[model samples]
Target: MTTDQWVIPFYQKQFKWLRDAEAEMANYLQIEANNIEEQIGIEFNSMLDIGAGIGSIARALDARGIAMTTLELVPDLVEAARRRSPKSIDIHLGDFYTYTFPKQFDVVSYFDGFGIGTDEDQLNLLKRMKSWVKDDGSLLIDIYHPNYWRTIAAGQKMKIDDAERIYSFDEEHCRMIDSWWHNEHPEEIVTQSLRCYTVDEASSMCEKAGLTITGIFPGGAMDFDNWTYKETAPLSGCLSYRIKLTKTI
Candidate 1:
C-alpha cells in the first residue's frame, strides 16, 4: 500500500486523542516557533498551516497570539480542527492544491502531514503553497531525515510504561523500511509506518517549488528531552527539520 492509503486511516484513528495529543504537539511547535520568530524577527500577521491535523500547530500559533487558518484534506480531521479552534479562524476541508486562499499569508507550513503524498504530489503541493505566501514569507516544515536510517537500523527502541517499540534496518538502500509499536497501545493497533526520502532529493524538490532552504533542524519530536538536534546525537533516523524557506522572486 502507498503512504497516503495507510496514513490517512492511521491519523483518523490516532486523532481520537485530539484532546491530549494536540496540546502536546502544540507545546513542541511553540518552542520551534519561538526559535524561528527570533531568527526572522517579524510578527506573522496570518498563517496557513497545511495539513494542520487536529489544529495542533495552528492551536500552538493561536496561543501565541497569531491568527491561523488550518487546511486539512481529511474530512474528520478538518471538522475536528474546526471544532477545536472554533473562535480562531477558518478550517478549510480539502486538498490545499484545490483550496483557494482569499489573500497571501505571512507564513505557510506543513507539519509532517505532507509526507503522506507521493513525490509528485509533494512537489505539486510545495509549489502551490509558494503561491500563497507573501513576499519574503517563511515556510516551516518537518520531515524525517533520510541519512539517519542507518543509525536507526542499528537497533533503536524506547519503553513507555510496560511496552516498547523498536526500529532496526539498513537505510542505504532506496527501499528503506522502519516500524514501531506503541508500548501502551494494543498489539493490533496501528503503529509507525515506513517512509523514505534522501535529503538531497527533498532539497532539490523544494528548490523546484521556488523556496530556498535556510535551516535544517535534526531531531524528531519524540519527547521533551530529545527535541533539539545536537552534533553529538547526529545519527538519528527519526529526525525533524525546521526548514526555513521563502517564495522565489
Candidate 2:
C-alpha cells in the first residue's frame, strides 16, 4: 500500500495505547525536548514540529517558554492535542508536504516519523521544510538507520496487551515494515512501511535539498528479548539517528 493509504490507519491503530500513558509520554517528551536543546545548542524562541504525533513534544517545549506550532495529518491526533495542550500552542491539521505556514520559525523538528515515501519524495519534503526555517535557524530531524533495521530478523514478533506486532525488513529497498494485529483477530493486519537511510545517504539528500548537515547524534534501540530500551547506542547499532541541519547559502 502507498504511504497515504497506510499512515493514518497504521498509527491510529498502533498508538491506541498512548491515550492511557500520559505520565510515561510526558517523561519521553521531556527527554526529547532536552535533546533538541542540547543538539541545536540554542535556546530557540520558536519551533515548528512536523508530524507531531499528539503535540507532546510541543507541550514539553512550550512549558520551557518556547513558542510552539505543530503540524499533524491525523484528525484524531490533532483533536487530542488540542484538547490536552495549552492554548499557546498553534496546532495545524494538514499534510506537511502541502501545508503552508504564515511565518518562519527559529527551529523546525520532526521526530520518529521521517521516512515515509520514495527518496525523491523525502527530498521534496526537506526542501519545503527549509523554507519554513529562518535563514539563521536550524532544522532537526530523526532519520531511521538502515543498519539497525537490517539486524531485525524477519517474523520477529512482540505482544503488547491484546495487540501483536511483527517486524520485517525489505532488504532490496532498505525499508522497515511493521505489521500489527489484535490477538482476537489474527487474520486482520495493518502495516506501516518506512524507508531507511544511512548517515551518508541522508547527507546527500540534505545537500541536494539545499540544506547542510551540521551534526549527527545516535538514537537508542529496543532490546526485544528483555523488553527494555537502551537510551544510547553506537551509530551503527542505533535504531535511528538525529541530524541537525541548516539552510545552505
Candidate 3:
C-alpha cells in the first residue's frame, strides 16, 4: 500500500563519514565516563557500541584500556570501521538485534541510532541491550527529541551533487528517506529509512525492558540544549539527549 519510492543503491557508494572522529569521541568518552563513575561509583571495564558508525568511540575507549566491540549492520561501514580500529577493539558486521557476543559488557551504547524502529521494536532493542550487559552495567543512548524533530518541515526534499544522494522526511511516521546513486549509473539507486523517537516514549520503552534512567547528558555540541541532570531539568527545544540507563536488577 505504500507508494513512496525507495531505492537500493546506497551500499554501492561510500558514505561521507568519519574514519576517526577523535576530538568528538574523546570529549564524549571523558564526559560520559566521568558522569558514570561519579554517579554510579564505578568505571566500565568493557563496552559494546551498537551502530558504531566509524569505530570512533571504540578506538577511543580502546586507547584507554577499556575492552571495546563495535557492532554495525552495514557491511561497508563495518569494514571501514574495522580497518580504522585497533586490534584490541573487535568490530562485527551484523545486526545488533540478532548478533551474538562472546560475553556481556560493562556498558552498552547506541549513539544516534535508537529510533530506527517502531515502539515495539525499539523496546525490543532495549530488552536485547539488557541481556548484553552485566548485572551492574549501564546503557548509554542518544535519542531524538520530538520538539525539534517536529520543527523540521516535512515533504521538503534535497539532493547533494557531491554525495550523489537525495533525502526527505516522512514526518507522519517520523521516518527519513535517504537515497544514494552513482553519477555514472544514476539508473541504479538505493535508499534507507530511519525512524526517530522522543524522550518520554524512549523512557517508557526502557521501563518495558527493565531499565532505569540514571542520568541525562545534555551537550550543546551534540545538539542537546544546556541542561543540568535534575528531576526538573527541561528538555524543550533540545534536538537530542544522551540518556544513561541501568538494569533493574
Q: After superposition, how far is residue 105 of candidate 3 from its true place, in Å?
A: 0.7
Give every collision pair in model 1. Answer: 153-169, 219-240
Question: Which ranking of candidates, highest lDDT first?
Answer: 2, 3, 1
Where does the lowest 10-residue lDDT sum fall in candidate 1?
171-180
Q: What's the count of clashing pairs in each model shown?
A: 2, 0, 5
Task: Count backbone clashes in candidate 2.
Answer: 0
Residue lDDT tens for model 3, 92-132: 88766678887999988888656665666777788889899
lDDT of 1 at 152: 39
What TM-score, to 2 decimals, does candidate 3 have? 0.74
Query: Which TM-score value belongs to model 1?
Result: 0.75
In terms of lDDT, the best-performing candidate is: 2
Best by TM-score: 2
Q: Global lDDT of each model?
A: 0.65, 0.88, 0.67
What is candidate 2's lDDT per residue for 1-249, written digit by digit as tens? 234688898778866733367676777878888889999997789999999988888999999999999999988889889999999999999988889998999999888889898888899999999999999999999998987887943567888877888889999999988888988888989988888999989999999999999999998988877878899989998999999999988
Model 3 is weakest, by summed lDDT over 10 consecutive residues, at: 1-10
What is the Cα-based lDDT of residue 124 in candidate 2? 91
Between the candidate structures 2 and 3, which one is better when assessed by lDDT? 2
TM-scores for every candidate against the unseen true structure: 0.75, 0.95, 0.74
